[model samples]
Target: MSAHSPLPSHELAIRVRALQVGFGTRLVLNNLELDVRRGEVLGFVGGSGTGKSVLARTILGLVQKRAGRVEVFGEDLDQLSKEGHRAMERRWGVLFQHGALFSGLTVLQNVQVPMREYLSLSPILMDELARLKIALVGLKPEAADKYPSELSGGMIKRAALARALALDPELVFLDEPTSGLDPISAAEFDELIKTLQQTLGLTVFMVTHDLDSLYSVCDRVAALADGKVIATGTIEQMLAAEHPWLRTYFHGTRASRLTLARAQSTGA
Candidate 1:
């Protein structure tokens, strides 16, 4: 096997090696290594300030890496020139933590921004594409004209998701997709993600703290600690882990409470 070979049978959508990021002298990500396979939902779970978002931004080329290689879809991010980067960026989409919608733009215009910038389709075509994406995320036709302020939190998230899907990207990055929503809404959003992943055959790299979302939507979970991926595996494997942090993270107080409640209800 070559030095680069790890899980060679799987098609790697994102690969990082010895990834280091720093804001001056303080290192954020320290010699991290990770791989995300094609058409899989890999959930990144870690405590705050563990570099989850930093890792995401580094992959997106929004932040400069101090050292190491980040390859997305087999293209080295560090080597891409400005034009090359933009060209490659068209292949992916990002749904940010707070939806990150332009407060000034209406929902339709927000979804059309990327299509206008990256695609040369005609005006009618762009409108049609925007509307199609909007509808796909379960938004009503009438919602398109409304501003971000007019929509509920769930609607805003769905609108942002619609915009993220506007380009039909093969790889999607979702940062805290279900954050700040009611339980019902969050579950609904998870269902939407699963539906879209199946329907579009997408590869999703999601950073989330929601355990229920992880159990429901993620194929694998990668836990970040000390700027490295400490543990990564299916939910069952993670649950079986004896690592202190892993145990506390997955089967913590809340989880134990839920389990006990279920046991009592079932008399098991």
Candidate 2:
């Protein structure tokens, strides 16, 4: 149908219906359904291996679905032609876990990878765009020339994010964006994500476990369990949920302490 030729008219940027995925004898996602709305930051949460990343990979067409319909920008992925698939890919970006930057490449070269793959531009222009993206993610210009090994944890994240933003994508898939950071650095990264989301009008599909990220940046949160989405709502709504996992997750000791501390600080 060549759905990529013209953008479809719909509120959803990504939709999954009756999805099933597995490895060998183990099932990962079963009859899972989800929707990421246009221009909204949707936080996807799950325990260590409940298939949050699997679902995201399925939507990105990185994982094969056994039985399901997956759509992005209103185009059914199963129906897209090769060229159509490439066109769809151009409209989105992804930040894999641990930044996944090439250990050998400088931040600038890493950020230019996508541009080099999907675009045909002069080296000068690519350099300029990559630097702009690095700056956009709050990295200083000098950091662009550093390799991933030489950068701090936060800088690695920012550098990878610059690569994700390289194509000026309308949709961004972030896997554990705040993982491996100190609390303060994590908070700062969350703020940067929020600012970029607002400034770019981006639809962000973030797979994360950070409660602070959920509370501060996500417009809505979806929790995965039993290979399906068990609950979806704001942080407040999640906190109020009575589901066993939700209750333990949101009201457990660490979560409770965070909530209480926020309350006390606000009162002061």
Candidate 3:
């Protein structure tokens, strides 16, 4: 058998070009363009009402784009039929903002839902696969029998993540992964994302308002303002950005106060 060839550096997992979305006459995304490289984390950050979630939904084909092209794994989204769309969706996994688990299904069944719908695996093999995915997300074996309503917020998130990884997708999209959790739980979740990315070589595209999470986990951040990407770079680079919106967003009064206190304490 021949050895597997390395993937090309320029090959993108997801690409959007001049994407436009609108609801009736109200424009959401305005000619937005983005590219998510393989095995990298790209964070989308903006204040409320910036249409970040709309852009994500457009890319996922949950909503129709008014204009522009969304290409996933190099296939034009508009070119796919209903059946073709289902086939393409198997290549991605999504962790919704609230861990949208089926309340009626147990954790194992929740994770196996996709497998049952998409694959022809036997019950034994499906169970084995579901268990492996649950374990991969650090869920206890016993938790597999529990329902979503019985699990804590963190467990629900983990179970949702397990379901997302059920198909071993090449691309994963997370929306507000840390929302509504205590600081400790949120930080733990961020670390979990880092660990999973390293272990599974997954490409993560997350939309969040958590500055701490952006600084801690993101390799690069794309800031959306006025329905377009205003800046995209490392945290340090974003800190140095001269755009008024970026500066105010990243080094605002709150951050400045924190910096001043630390500086006075350390004399730096």
Top TM-score hit: 2
Q: Judged by lDDT against the true structure, how good is candidate 2?
A: 0.89
| Clash number by candidate, in order | 0, 0, 0
Cα lDDT tens digits for candidate 2, 132-172: 99998889999999999999988998899999999989999
Weakest 10 consecutive residues of candidate 1 by summed lDDT: 1-10
* lDDT values for all models: 0.88, 0.89, 0.85
Q: Which stretch of 10 consecutive residues in model 2 shows the poorest summed lDDT?
A: 1-10
Better of 2 and 3 by TM-score: 2
- Rank list by lDDT: 2, 1, 3
Ranking by TM-score: 2, 1, 3
Pairs of colliding residues, candidate 3: none
**Best-matching candidate per lDDT:** 2
Question: What is the C-alpha lDDT profile of model 3 across 27-98, one tens digit per residue?
Answer: 878988777777888899988988888888888978988889888887888898998899888878999888
Q: For residues 1-268, what per-residue lDDT tens digits would candidate 1 score against the true structure?
A: 1113366534888988999998888888999888888898999999888889999999998898989999888888878899988887888999988898899999999999999998899999899989999998889999999999999988999999999998999999999999898898898888989998898899999999988788889998888888888878887778887778889988898866755675697795
Residue 239 of model 3 has an lDDT of 83
